[model samples]
Target: MPSDVRALLARHLPGREARSLVPVGQGLDNVAYEIDGELIVRCAREPDPEATRAEVAVLAAVAPISPLPVPEVVFSDPSAGVIAYRRLPGRPLHRHPVADPRRLAEPLGAFLGALHAVPPASLGELVPLDRYPLADLREEAAQEYEAVAAHVPPEHRRLVEDFLAADPPADPLAESPEEAAAGTAGARLCHNDLGAEHLLADPGTGTLTGVIDWTDAALTDPARDFARLYRDLGPEVYELTLAHYDGRLDDAATGRVRFLARCALVEDLAHGLGPGPRHYADAALAHLVRTFTG
Candidate 1:
């Protein structure tokens, strides 16, 4: 543990000694550490501290209303850019291989639906939608695709460009104006990155025990949350999960799902081709093409 980390922890959790600081896992923008016994500390790597503060605030606000258990922010010091939370019980859903995806689908979908049901008025000021806009995502994809096009095969490059060129769907599933609004009224407190890794589940029951990682939490389109399920789990599981949520394969929802799936694929591709690219990019791209075209 860094000396700075010890000092930071000492400031918030006074008296108690921070026994062992072990690296927990890699986060998109923050480094996570499992503090002594039950506490988890997240520190910002970049200069920006707002993200940490926002996460703390959002978690605090949503803890009472959220259907599934959320980590409680026990200690937070935005200046030090470190936030501490009481670690919940159970392991992330991804930790144990899910033998039957259907069994887990209902609980996951219902949990998400309940989360979306939280009135937007309840959540205070959240990050703007423009920050996570589909247009911005598309632009980023185009830029990243151009930069890495040379390394990609000619055939793959053409296909990616063509996919990028296709316009995104306008109709969204959450029809209520409140549901449509990104940050203000329509936006529910959303766990923007709801992957298996973020979900804690009981191995025996296959039920979601807790939802972790609030760094990307925002008040945005509920469909974005559903899109996450589609991308992380395959189509069959995705369909099952949506069905569990009473989500129909309507044209509007389907179109939006297709668009978001493509966007997520592009996002994954951009990150995958970064310094030490991961192999999952190929799978994401393949899935994107199949879903969009089919």
Candidate 2:
């Protein structure tokens, strides 16, 4: 552990006995430490106190109403961009193979249903509107595909090219004059980064355990989350997940989900080939074949 981290723990947790303290994850924005396998302490990589504060508040707001367990803030020092919470159970779904993947569908659906039901206005101050337009996603995916296409297998190249040539789905939030006028009228509270790396499950039974990493929570189209589910887990689980979801699932939403899933897949593949960790690239390659072929 770094000297600064040790000092932070010494100052805040004066008498608590910790058998072990070790770094667990180092992402672009934060460094996380596991304390005795029970607590998670995360410190922001940048000095963004406001963002850290928002994450703390969002976790508090989400914990009570979430269908699955979410991290609960136990200690915080927003000025330092540090917070600790009791570690929720289960490993990230991407890292652990579940005995029966189908079993996770219902709970995953219910979890998303609960999140989408929360009025965006309720968490108006803490979460910002996810302003990333679908056009931007398409543009980025195209750029990424250009860089990584040579590495992709010949069999999958045509599928990828076809996706790139296709027109994007209509934006459900901006479809109608009334919805456009209302500004985020069709939007909902969303776990805007609901990828497999953030989803947790029981390795033995495939039970949904918890969701983590709320830094990307936002007021956005619900289809984005659905897209992530489809990209990471595949169609069968995605369809079953939707079966349990109680929110909007019309043709427009389905179109957005499909389009967004493809965009995300391309982005992940590119990242995996670049500065991202080997696991990211490995997972993306596996999903790419599964996503395009299946």
Candidate 3:
């Protein structure tokens, strides 16, 4: 696949030969490579030419409008489900912890504001609508917790259990509890999988260089993206982010953010103890302590 990818780059972007092709990351849906440290090449695990084409279009539309750096596609081969983008600078926030996470507040806030401001109707057809059911999220979290419970710290077990037993907050945009539970009120185009690993930053300056991996980008609950910050960075950063955001999310939406954050934390914790990178588990464990104690 690397050889194929190199050939694709050579063909589409002639003269930009890859000197070193290093596997940087792999998720369930895609595998990513860094080409000579200047470019990122991602190939979908499942070949879907149409989806790859749509993603290329989505990146093109978003790059101009986003306040922070987003992927700039240099080469794309929809037939091979491969896309190459100019590499954005900075290390991921998870692996490279900043001295002050609060530094992320303003830029991240402004970035998300710009993203959510894009008219959902503009990319409505290209991106899928993700109404991740609240019931399903909770049930999945519960199951994940059970699978990794023995690895969880004794001090945090009670809090984890309590969160699992509690009901999720009602969807602010939904008309009724039933509608909320069914997740019928997703209202904005969101980076549905925003998390520390995908957030790149300059470790020294605490400047967010980019938000990567838009594979899960969708029209979903606005709070969903915010929840990642809350879960990974804590409340102060979350609240500061809200301050800079041009859009208003009322108290109910804020509640939903907290609810989703806790749910996501469980999944992170499980991932940490599972097959994911060591930093994932480390970050999750630290977040767990910071969340309840700080």
Candidate 4:
């Protein structure tokens, strides 16, 4: 642990003695630490204080409503840029790879379904649609593509650029009227980043125990949750997840899913350009090409 982090924890945790602190893996923006034996602390690297506060607020709102286990926020001090939660047992789903994809698909689908059931109206004053609009996502992707064009193979670059150029279908998903009805029908709070790494599954039974990381939780198109299923698990698991969701996927929802999947691909390319860029970029371009051309 950095000396500064120790000082920060000491300041926030008060009398609790942190016998040992070790660096734990974190997502793009936050750093994670396992402190002592009972607590997990997350420190935000981003300057925005609202980000940490928003996560704590969202967790508090959704804890009772969500069926799956979500971390309980023990302490949140935005001034310090730290949030702590009681650590839960279980490993990320990606850690214990299931030879049978179906096993993973079933639990993942059910967990997502349960998460999506939380009414949007229930989450008071959390991040709104403007923070993660489709238009914004598109613009971000365009910028990222430009930055990494030189790094990408010319063939792949052409495919990605062309797909972006094609104006996303106006009525590609559902008919306008149907979409309007769905919107008015009421939206649900969704875990926008429901990837394998964020999910914890039991090593023995392969049951999902907990869903961690609420940094990207948002009240937006519910279809966004399915994007991870398609991107990570492919069509079979994607279908299973949709089926388990127990909701009808109209043309609009299907269209939104496709659009979001494409957006995630671009977002990954733009933001995750490193040693792993080649793999992620290739997958994104491939999915975009296959979906658009097919």
Candidate 5:
């Protein structure tokens, strides 16, 4: 299969001799292979027109404006569900935390600051958020809550359930219940799935090399970008990251971020319960404890 994939991708990489096609990545939505040492070929695991379109479009638009390097789409054939991009340098951040989490926080924050600042009009079409008239989002979050509730420890169950409710108190952020219910403060382009796995950095220097995987890129509440910051790093790093942002997220904007944080737990818990290596549910429950109690 790898050889067949290599043959298929040969026409795309015209000059460089294709040396090896190594299976490198398997994310929820995509399966990726490293062709030679320089490029990546990815195919969707499921039919997602929006994700495919985003990959083809968002990368080109954000490349010049983003503070960090993003993948350069060398070739794409979405219809065939295959696209190859020049693999960016460095390893996933989780494999190697930035040497200086403090300094790294600023640029990361600044990068997102710059990222959100790019004119939305220029980004072409991206997946829009599941916003307003909360019927759908509420239902989805409830489903996630149902899946995770039993796994949550007793002490944290109430808090997680509260957040899972169709309407819950701010718990931490958001201006009002009404605003929280609506799920929109200000909408902008978002990586949608910003996590350590998608962030690449130099193992030696911790210098961030790139922000990859824009398949879920969308025009949504900016907080979606920051949801993982505090959970993955720490408050200090989270604050520093936010401090460097050029754009301002007001009470409303930030409120949505917090709201999304709660909303996102479903996926987090699911990943933990699913085939992942780690028991994310434990961490997920711990996060909930901090959210309400801390």
Candidate 6:
């Protein structure tokens, strides 16, 4: 199989041999192999042709514009559900503490700023940004809540719902998930799956080196990016991220960010409650208490 993958790359690359190929990563959506430990070859685990094509198109367009290193689709064959690209440096951010969160925030903010600034029209036939209608998110949140309703402590269930439904708090630190669904922030291209796991980082330097997984990329509320920042690193990092951004997210936009942040916690706690750490649930509980009391 390594020989086959290498042969595939050879065909596309012409002169360069894609060597030392070995399976390196596997997940729900993709199974990846590193070639010479410098390049990555991936195949979609499912049958999603449109997504395969869009990922290639989006990467090709964004790599040149992104402030951080992004994968280049060195070779792609949607018909075979195969793709190859030069791997960027660093391990996944989730694997290490961002040593100096403050310093990393500056570049991360710049990276997202450049990402959002990309012209969506240039994305061509790739999936466009989702509007993520207020109604849809509300329904999704309700569904996620229902998924875990049985496990929530009886006393905390109602409070959970309120947090999901309330408007942004008058205070920036306090707010509801609903307000996050509705905010004044202008929409732009977003990495719909910009999670901590997707952020690649240099542990030695405490700096992010790359952003990955654009299969779900689209133009959506900028808050989606902000929300992930809030969830993965907490509000302090989120604030630093925003402070470094070239764009401005007004007060209403902040309401949305806070709400979405809370929603992220609830969605996880409510629907995925067994056999894993409760860190997210704990965070959600703390925010819920702060929201209800303040």
Model 3: per-residue Cα lDDT at residue 81: 84
After TM-score superposition, the amount by which residue 195's alpha carbon in candidate 5 deviates from its true location, in angstroms, is 1.7
Error of 4 at 76 (Å): 1.7
TM-score winner, 1 or 3 = 3
- lDDT digits (tens) for residues 7-66 of candidate 6: 777777888875477886655567789988888888777747777888888887788888
- CA displacement after TM-score superposition, residue 205 of candidate 5 (Å): 2.2
lDDT of 3 at 209: 92
Q: Residue by residue across 142-174, what tens digits does model 1's lDDT show?
A: 887776666565655666777789775663345
The TM-score leader among the candidates is 2
> Could you tell me the TM-score of candidate 1?
0.81
| Runs of candidate 1 exceeding 4 Å displacement | 47-49, 93-96, 130-133, 148-162, 171-186, 202-205, 246-251, 275-294
Give model 3's TM-score versus the native structure. 0.91
Query: lDDT per model, in order?
Result: 0.68, 0.82, 0.82, 0.68, 0.69, 0.70
Per-candidate TM equals 0.81, 0.94, 0.91, 0.79, 0.81, 0.76
Off by over 4 Å in 6: 1-23, 121-124, 149-159, 165-185, 267-294
Per-residue lDDT for 1-294 in model 3, tens only?
889888888899888778899998876678999999999999888878988987888788888988888889888888888888999999887778799999899998888888888876577487887876787889998999899888778978998888789888765576457546755464677888889888999998888899888877887888999999998889899989999999756568877787788788888777767766566667777788556433
Q: Candidate 2 — which pairs collide?
A: none
Residue 157 displacement (Å), model 2: 1.3
- Candidate 2 per-residue lDDT over residues 1-294, each given as its tens digit: 466666777788888767788887766678889889988888887757888888888988998989999988888888888888899888888889687777888998899999899966577588988757777778888999999999888888998888887777666556467557768756788888899888888898788888988888888889889888888898888889999999865568877887788888888878878876567767777888667655
In TM-score terms, candidate 4 sits at: 0.79
Clashes per prediction?
1, 0, 0, 4, 0, 3
